[model samples]
Target: MSWKGFSLDSATSERRRPGASRVTAVKILIAGGFGAGKTTLVGAISEIPPLTTEAIMTAAGVGVDDTGGVPGKSTTTVAMDFGRITIAEDLILYLFGTPGQNRFWFMWDELARGALGAVVIVDTRRIEDSFAALDFFEHLGLPYLAAVNCFEGAPRYDAEEVRQALAIAGHVPLALFDARSRDSVRQTLIAVAEHALRTLTAGRPRP
Candidate 1:
């Protein structure tokens, strides 16, 4: 869609509830490999219209960007996608979807600053494509969960099987979902928030 600048005051006014306590906005990053449905997940779950910077793929990117698994994909997210959702009367979530290509990964360090956690979306067919994202988050020690986006006609695997294939840690949350479904996306976000909160609590220093 169209792009516009974001402001805290404006976002608060739009998402605030009557007689609610002060708002707490938590930032989360949506990350994955190219064509893994990061943009679609944000758009499906966001209350406000999502801001996206997408450009049509051209011959120029043929050598640089790999399109082996997703040959039909014609567009790419050139920058981050922004969206907002209210989890409770006093709690809001700001979602930032990172650009998937390696070249755009430099922006992730900035996008991930102050983020409470992240969601790594995976395509079953291109499971290997998500390794970079997993490594990035793990290296930075950011709390995150893995979501397997069920694409049509794509091979399906159970959560445990996928987790083993990805070599995800035992404590990390892993789930299956369809990015296009609002309910599924919402559930996935809830899982991520729960996992993040647990990690934070566990890491707290004892009094």
Candidate 2:
């Protein structure tokens, strides 16, 4: 399949017949501020129907939940989003999307345990909303990629400009994507995986 602009090889290649016992699983976290498309992304790329724990917005959150940039949003994730995708015959990715509201932030540490890396989705209209998520990953020293989710009417910024605005280090990868597209989501995942792999190898002792 073609993701972003690159073609991916067939996942059927280099695989044992059905029932092979050598499959490897990698955990990936999808994190962002409220209304940044975390749930949308997990649903788009999951092989199975994604599991979500969304609750309707109500008067109770009128003053507490910040709905400035996402005025139309009516639901929020209370727990987490879960999904799975098989990128290759032997490689499976387990996706866990964190709850975006600050009240739900306590769940992040549990979800991040054993995760290979994360994709921090950003909404250009509410760029500052993502700061907490970015700081969370940085403080843990986790390798991650910042993915700017393009939305209709949102201002467009070049990669360097976004990097500078977000104060992302030169080593971290940054890219743009449409979270609703399967190809785009796959491409983002590829970037995260590549970044994590590089960081892992770099920390290892040379042979």
Candidate 3:
């Protein structure tokens, strides 16, 4: 909720482990369309209290912002959300959640600069809303996985069906998760990390 003690500069600084084990810090982006739950997912899984830049929705965004599918939503992330989680003693993940509105997209390039990979959260109710995120990561050639956030009362589809609908590459990992659950989100993050590692490995030049 507040970033009083945390700064991006300090958060990304090298950390030392006093023993033989070394610590590796990873940056990950949480991206998706408006109201797709990027904020919620980060908050649920973050070990530290997440930093959020949410603002109340107003009449000024009436025509520019679309909230039809998420009629009850009244707030939006105006900037990025920051959070940290330790996957292991040697591995820490720093999450950056991008703002979903078109006007804030210019910040994506910066948020994604050092990110190892991304998790594209999707809402089946507005499945089409996820296309822009998919395209952006694909164009950047960044390794990422699609995560379908199963909101209550929303129509459900199996993983394969959703994958086909999204038209993602067959090898890309696809997962179904409840964004509100810490366990579910943790599993999703692990999946993306593994997927990204495999992708990096496969692309390395053979010795």
RMSD in order of candidates: 6.3, 5.9, 6.1
Full ranking by TM-score: 3, 1, 2
Model 1 regions lying over 4 Å from their true place: 1-18, 204-207
Worst 10 residues of 3 by lDDT: 1-10
> Per-residue lDDT of 1-207 in model 1, one digit per residue for the tens?
111122333222333447855566778899999999999999999999999998999999989998888888999999899999877666678999999998898899889887777999999989998899999999888889999999787899988999999999998999899999999998998888777767765773211
Report the C-alpha displacement of residue 113, candidate 2, in angstroms: 0.7
Off by over 4 Å in 2: 1-21, 204-207
lDDT of 3 by residue, 36-118 (tens): 99999999989999999999999999998999899999999988999999886767889999999998899998898877789
For model 2, residues 54-160, the per-residue Cα lDDT tens digits are: 99988999788898888889999999999998876556778999999988999999888877789999999999988998999998877889999997878999989
Clashing residue pairs in candidate 1 are: none
Q: Please report the candidate that would top TM-score against the real structure.
A: 3
Instruction: Give the C-alpha lDDT of model 2.
Output: 0.84
TM-score of 3: 0.90
lDDT of each: 0.84, 0.84, 0.85
